[model samples]
Target: MEERLPGADRLPVGRRPSEGLRLPAPDRALSSRTGYTRGTWLAVADHLLDSLGPWFTPSGAQVRLPGRGSWSGADCDGLEGYARSFLLAAFRIAATEGDDRLVERYTRGLIAGAAGEWPRLTPCSQQMVEAAAIAVGLHESRAWLWDRLDGPDQQKVVDWLSGFVGSKTWDNNWRLFQVVGEQFLASVGAPYSQDDIDSGLDRIEDWYVGDGWYTDGDGQNFDHYIGWAMHLYPGLWTRMAGTAADERLTVYGDRLRRFLEDAVHLVGADGAPVHQGRSLCYRMAAAAPYWMGMLLDASPLTPGQTRRLCSGMLRHFVDHGVPDERGLLSLGWHHHFLPVTQSYSGPGSPYWASKGFLGLLLPAEHPVWTDREEALPIDEDDQVRAMPAPGFLLQGTRHDGIVRLLNHGSDHAAPGEGEPPADHHYDRLAYSSRTGPELTADRIDNHVALVGPDGTSQRGRIRRIAVDGRRAASWWKVGASRIEVASVVLGRVEVRCVLVDGPGGVTIRHGGYAIADQQRPEATTAGTWAQTVRTDRLTSVVVGLHGYDEAGVRLGLDTNAFGPHSATPYLVRREHPGGPVLLVSAVVLSGDTVWPEALAEAIEVEVDGLRCVIRMAGGPEEAEEVVMDGGGTPAAAGETS
Candidate 1:
């Protein structure tokens, strides 16, 4: 008995009562873990498409969904609604052989849009972004939608799409839009610039730093875009080009295979993607590359593992009330937490998650659908992996089903003078599957800064020094002061060491993970340790192992995507006698109860001049030692348990 948007009952085609998404019953036989079958995917697609019935304009050229418009304004937002949803509808129609109602609905929109109902595409405009989605939809549903259009309407469509020819785009992933759109034009015998397409493809080569990693554009800008946009578009472009793409296909495929090898370790046992990076409002779109892997047969993961990973991701959001009661994807994470969205995130922007539905393109008999679900890396045992390309250290614990990312690189900073201020999403020292960085005033979660008269120093432009096994190191500047940080991850804890080379009397602050929930989290500070525990028993703890003199918790309201109430544990060194001072802290986030004093007791720290050594005692295993020099460079003497 969900409420429908205006004009829902007036639709002439596949309209149904608005009861939210009507998913199929769990098919445990096929999907033993997530219970999401191909039928489940189809049902969700139809439900999403049908829910849009009330939003379309009379001419069907635009879909004006109810929500705040993006900075691009309402005109671009309307086109976004139509084009993004059209992509979803196209996926459904193509997979089902032909959904007559869907084909007709989107076809009408296309014709009306081609007849000038939609806005003209312009250089570096949001319209150019939607044009790529429209081009892909038309290419995928050519037989039913594109081919059936009258010759005049087809010409009009070509004229509209031709805007991509010789047009400039932002140097990032937007380049791929022109590549795909012009390639689609070429497929239809329309005018296209091979140079435009080739240049876009070639531009990404400059950003690819091997190990299957691409920097989005430049300057260590790594995030989910690496999966959803960077890899997804090239794979789809190759599919659209067919035999002509064979050479590039092999190259892109190899890179994708290597990327997936590292990506498989990023997801938690509960299927949550590590909450890092920007544009996170596109929730499950992180799975697009995994689906692309299956599409191009370019993945090292087995069919069972691939399905498990994708299904787990989709179900993770669905279970968390992603679509809400209205069956609409909002510009937020689990709920309407706007901090997770960017200025370009309109109501329909989340539908770019449609790319995740790429799996539906495979035949029903494909092993990805038929194979039984398998466990992810986190479901088996604890894992610690280093991705040097992005300078990330991934640590996953099997007991708690949590995955933590110790980020030594990927700050989203451009390479030049006057870099933009540090963003909470990219500048945090750590991110995890279960916790989000605090975004409220005086943000402190997973950060280290020197509090000065001007303000807290920003961790500007991370310069990575090393990312080796179980350890990573990086250095950044706080005005004239130089700050070096190294992390050694073990089990559920990360030993963070910092070296400060600044003037004296300024306080140094270090923060732990931010835990959030519906209710105010339980927080405590005693002696040299601080802790915050959510209602669900998710815990965050920080202990002052050295240099820090005080510990406390920072409270936030509506500043996190995971919940409305959040708390972060932090330690502060008061009146630091700072020139080249060394500080050490143990940071932990887990589902189990942790005693900060006991944890501090278990970890023994010894410092002689600038060189520091840390030995962490394991319950049943031997102690692990990490040695660090003056610059906070860590060399582990033993393996992580």
Candidate 2:
């Protein structure tokens, strides 16, 4: 049954509730739908809040997740977590027209947190993160909670938050932490350093790479932080600034508007965002930009479309056990898969996903709730969008609703750096909405490696050459070897051709999707010609079109971080002596709705030295010719960078 927004259109925007006015209750039945309405989102928020009952202390200061992981190991982690999650609860209550029960519960905690009734956070820099969350929550609920606080209590809140005034923060997204807290302090007529706020905002401008994208910190670290933190705070800061908004506010709005165009495409038709980047634990936080855009009226999506995107993402996690049976979120992607966490992750980190509830602050009378839900970009049709700023080629297949990201840019390492530690998250050749980074020990899947003469493999830092339409090219070097690759994608099929000129006997290993061993993954091998692995729900296959020799395909148990087992279908070709050697192959991945078997009949390849012709099965019968340029003369073994 379709969810209808009852009486929401009749309500006025930003209607204030009288003393005893009751808010609309969330419909439980909506939770079961594959797609979501506003009520479904609220239901999830409420479910998250209720789960805290067992963990929440009587004073509302500490929420202890005894079984979960912790970072910082400070005594205040409990308090920090409670405050962060309470912020989400506060937004939901305020947005839902003041839910008395939830509001009272969260307001008590807010007052306690701001008043320092709980254990204080360690004086370390990491405290800035939790402080920012507290400030944002308080700012969002100002009318409902902050205004209700007595003068002394309000002063205490200021005094507590003042800890961030001159605190040192990391150069990356951490700058926004200070920016938001100080901005909130200024909004309340609290003493705040204009210089500090200006500095925080200024640094963000330096990180901007245009086309509405900002690398998280520096060195090609672009990830979801662009949405959750970078874009989110600026939009919220603008609202807090109001008519006092400066030129930067207009700039922020413009950037957000431009960003939504690409951000919306990052989400799969099934609601999963691109599973690339650190901190996969913050599941639905990806939806924050969608809500932030809607709140500022600065997004390209319609109000209905905004809700659809946010709701879809939230439902995606909820259905996948984001908040497990105990209603507690773990430090993992879907379930408690810990490999997805960064060093900074703690039990409460998942609460950051609460930022998605920023939409709850939007009144029901708003078009976002009243308008009929609209489909996302992928829901409409198959899409392939090239994001130059992040060096990502986003391809979404309408048939399976899976979005795949072909990475040529982001590596989390700085340029000019030789071979940095391989961060499986950013270093992977590709990321997908339906799959995760192969966080196993070797972390070799979805990457092309140059196996050294010493038997060790090295992956190079990628420099994006160009992104045109459905194709992208990149150049990178490992030791004395320089490699160039170009990718052309069609539906779930990607045709990648690599040219390498390295050491005398360097072999190239190109691995396809690291498909999880879900539902008893079985493999079918066609020797050196092609290889495939199929689970009941999905299929991953790689075929050698034009390569030197040899194919290496294997099922790797416990090789995936997301699932216990996975298999990587790969094609290995030994490099010919001295000159440039080219490896051409086709990789296909499809869900239950699409049969990858069709790609075998659809693909045709012809190779001529450095040039190759690729004709996708059902095309115009015309083959596209690709020329390869091998990096200058190969260096000897000891010629290191």
Candidate 3:
């Protein structure tokens, strides 16, 4: 009875051996009769575990910045999540390479890092899955050094980690971490009460969402956190412990596979996943699915594809940027800038990407071994897909799997919208287009509270649904009159809109880039009725938006990256009060292949009309200017006549 480590976790930090460590042959499913190069695994793992990885210190278990800033200590809660990556990597390497030395170094490293009596008495504050991973790693390894440690030392590790199981803050990630850690420790002869483990399991059930998802906290919990920490730990822990009664753990893996299957198609031929959320600080964590694939026999992904996906994902970040100037994972993408991370995200978090090692869990002869790597589905052809993520319609398409993303959601609460806000933002109905690194983070300007999926509703959080089909819908704070660019594939283009009430019925139409007359939409409504609209194939589109900001109102258009195949271009009209209302324009990709712009040419101010008609051709430019139109009802009262 022990926690399971993969074939690569065991290794010393900072230096690499002249020859890489030798890993054992994977079970046939992972490769053919011939074992693959164990050193390849060693090099990759070593590079990750080396001191270049997260820096742990004696004074405090801090994730150090390489150059600037003081070595900040992990808030007690954040400490274990930080160490988990190192320990998981160490244990994983030992499993694969049969390197007992590697396991000993890290096990001792954990004990040394735990240092004094503080850890034994205080569980990590966050109660996150990260620390649980480390606990499980060591419990499983029962590594060379475990027997050598004084009873007090080993007890310190268990007590520190186990203590988290019963804390009140055992909030979301905290309990999740407890479940995995406790499961692992109990498996390895540690005396965590079965009652505690069962209770922890019950608490986790409280947050489970169907389709393989669980929100770490209340509201719409959507992001890599689900993949990396939540379902990830539960799935791995149950597998390691062979816990059959933990239906939630088994279900978590199945659901995770569903999410990965539904999602893997979105990554283009190059393996670039869409980036959305915090600790993107942990860059490659998105690829953690590849490891899960190895852990579960029912995976939809192929081994070669897993290898390609993980390897490609790894190289993408490392090539683009993972470590900043100091050899430590930086705080931001392209540079150091994120000031909003929970203490847990320090440099060490990214290696949780080691979940990638799940790929090593395979038996060597698997087809992932024999099958030639196929180009990812996204890179293979042109298609449209819709998924419910974060919140909104996530439509993805690709040209031979070259990626294209169309974000049809509200941008009401980006960074600066709340205390920590988001790490990325763009002003006008932001939607990220990606060919390489994570792009959604680029949009960080919504000025409202950006809580989870249920954050918007009266429930005061984002609404979510669990597998039992129990429904929950919290109207997360949303940008009124919000708009998003959905998909731009090859020569075809499409943008979607979900309009809430706004100044003058949330008008949108095109002007400068308008094509000659063709069938155009008369209106867009939340009602089931699809307004009168048509589409004309054009090489470019000009979608404009006009809404009110806190300051009176603002006018803008989603028309900057102007091209049929490029990210949709949107520009806001700069407005000053005064002047007879002029013209407004909008661009639409009507159901048909043909498209034509509808223009509103009226120039009068109607004081109380909540609904403003966007007359076809020459209609007023749908003003993005926020005018308190008609009792907050954007339909009648304050329409400009």
> Please, what is the whole-model Cα lDDT of each candidate in the order they appear?
0.85, 0.73, 0.42
| lDDT of the structure predicted as candidate 1 | 0.85
Backbone clashes in candidate 3 total 135
Give the Cα error of residue 302 in candidate 2, in Å. 2.0
Model 1: residue 581 alpha-carbon error in angstroms? 1.2
Top TM-score: which candidate number?
Answer: 1
- Compute the lDDT of residue 58 as modeled in candidate 2: 79
State the displacement of the C-alpha of residue 584, model 1, in Å, after optimal TM-score superposition: 1.1
Best by lDDT: 1
Superposed Cα RMSD, model 3 = 12.1
Rank list by TM-score: 1, 2, 3
Shift of residue 108 alpha carbon in model 1, Å: 0.7
Residue 168 alpha-carbon offset, candidate 3, angstroms: 2.8
Please identify model 1 stretches exceeding 4 Å from their true place.
1-18, 619-641
lDDT tens string, model 1, 420-504?
5768889999999999888855768998988878778778778777899888988777777878888988788898888888788
